[model samples]
Target chain A: MTMFTRSDKVSETGGGAKPPARDDTPAPAEAKRPQATAQPLSHTAPPPPPKAAASTVSVISKALKITGQLESTEDIQIDGMVDGDVRGVSVTVGGDAKIKGTVYGEEVKLSGTVDGKIEAQRVVLTSTAHMSGDVVHQNIKIEAGAFINGHCRPDFGKPESKALPPPHKPAAAPPEQKRDAVVGAP
Target chain B: MSALSLSSLVKPPRRDDAEELPVSHLGRALTVRGVLDTEGEIRVHGKVLGRINADCLVLDTGGLVEGDIVARDVRVSGRLNGRIFALHVTLDSSADITGRVFHHTLTMAKGARVEGRMPWRPLNYFETLEQLPETRQ
Candidate 1:
């Protein structure tokens, strides 16, 4: 009989009892909630900035100096001095930059000084560019004020067949053609 | 600005222009196999297979360094496989380091994984660190 009476009372007060029970429980739950949320917030807050900074283009600023090779699948902007080879997809050599070794890239834009060779599909030498070595490219553009002291060859894709013919033919062909014309006239 | 001024005061008098030097960023797809020397700050997000000498070095997440680091302030959120000689070292939660850290002051987050000894030294130890001891290579 007592159990049956308690069951009836529980059913009658179920809706009314839950609110007070929740009110009593929330005092402790609210305290634990902030601590739980704060822990994760502190742990997760510091990593996003570094991750975002990492995904962008690399900048070798003017204050830095690298003494070896730098290989990148992405773009590289160099404003410093590099004593070794640089390989990138799109390479921008700033006006104050200096490279002592070879530069290999898909597209190379030079406004600085490259003491070594540049091997790329497309090469652009701006007004401030000072190139001292050979440049092998498929398409090349030399600005008016650019200084190039070496050969600029358009043989970029095929290296073997075209490499040996250009230098020898320009030097040897004119005299041979003149002698042949004179002998044929006589 | 105040922090910069404070750090400048605390640092040595040799590099007064350290705060004005621009930070160098090594992006994720880049791989450098040489010595990176800077007077300012360097943030490495790629792979560096050589030594780094900087005023401040931040090894960001996903970055991997496989050599020695000599810096004044070192903050690591990436993976390192070499020794560190710094005055102040802060290891974030995502840092996975596997070498010795010779630091004057060290702060490590909860989830950082370090697998070598961290020996604390006096402040003068870092000041006089002109040449690294050749006993341990």
Candidate 2:
């Protein structure tokens, strides 16, 4: 998925796995500065394309610890300890992870401990999840063994819209309004 | 030059461990504000504003890191505004660093712009650097 990655996420893009037409271009095997090699080739000089190798996913390794806010447009996989708020598109709290502040995301999958609130469109609390605050989600899948000490709210968008008629409308507006709500609330 | 460096003292070396562990890459669009500690290599293409402790750190061009870095091997190609404590350090041509660099061995490309003191330490100094020096406010 090319959700929120940049054009040159991986250095290997300078070498192999290029398109058939790009093979003739002279690319450095390990291009330290990819833009320098990429700029001269295309005469039109179109913006560099973001390939599959250019992963924008940020991984918080198990040994890491953060004490400040983390905001990202791309996916974030946290396996360490965080003492502040996290905002991302897909925020995954790994099994040993511990987040001590609010988490805002489109999809939040938790398998560890969260001492603060969670606001997301879709929330999945795995068996290892230990939540200590309120959870706001539109669609929830809580495993049987999950531990939660917060109020689960199904309202993430227009609160009155949940009671509105037209069940087929659930397909289109929930996501659009949820994004707006998240932006407005913050 | 190699005799007094930590690279000669450490048997396996930091780059050797990088091949064995899982490397984490942060693309240019990401921004982080916190502490990152890992045994593996970390390639930063984004912006980081906090402390980073890794075996090897490679800051790519256009990347920016603001804070302290404690690693065995540090390679900077972008901009950095913090202290660095590493056994071996390499500043590329595009590097723009403004802080202290405590290293046992160093290599600077022709065009690297460094605005700080590079204090050379012994291998034992790096081995015993469990905590970074307190920064002046």
Worst 10 residues of 1 chain A by lDDT: A40-49
Worst 10 residues of 2 chain B by lDDT: B1-10
- How do all models score by TM-score? 0.73, 0.66
lDDT by residue for model 1 (A29-144), tens: 44543353354212211212255545568899888889899999999999988989999999999998999999999999999999999999999999999999999999999999
lDDT of 2 by residue, B1-119 (tens): 01123233244444444455555667777788877766666778889999887767888788899998877768888899999887667787789999989886676666899998989
The number of the candidate with the highest lDDT is 1
- CA-lDDT, candidates in order: 0.81, 0.75
Q: How does residue B132 of candidate 2 score in lDDT? A: 31
> What TM-score does chain A of each model score against the native chain A?
0.60, 0.58
Q: What is the lDDT of candidate 2?
A: 0.75
**DockQ for each numbered candidate:** 0.32, 0.23
State the weakest 10-residue window (summed lDDT) of model 2 chain A.
A41-50
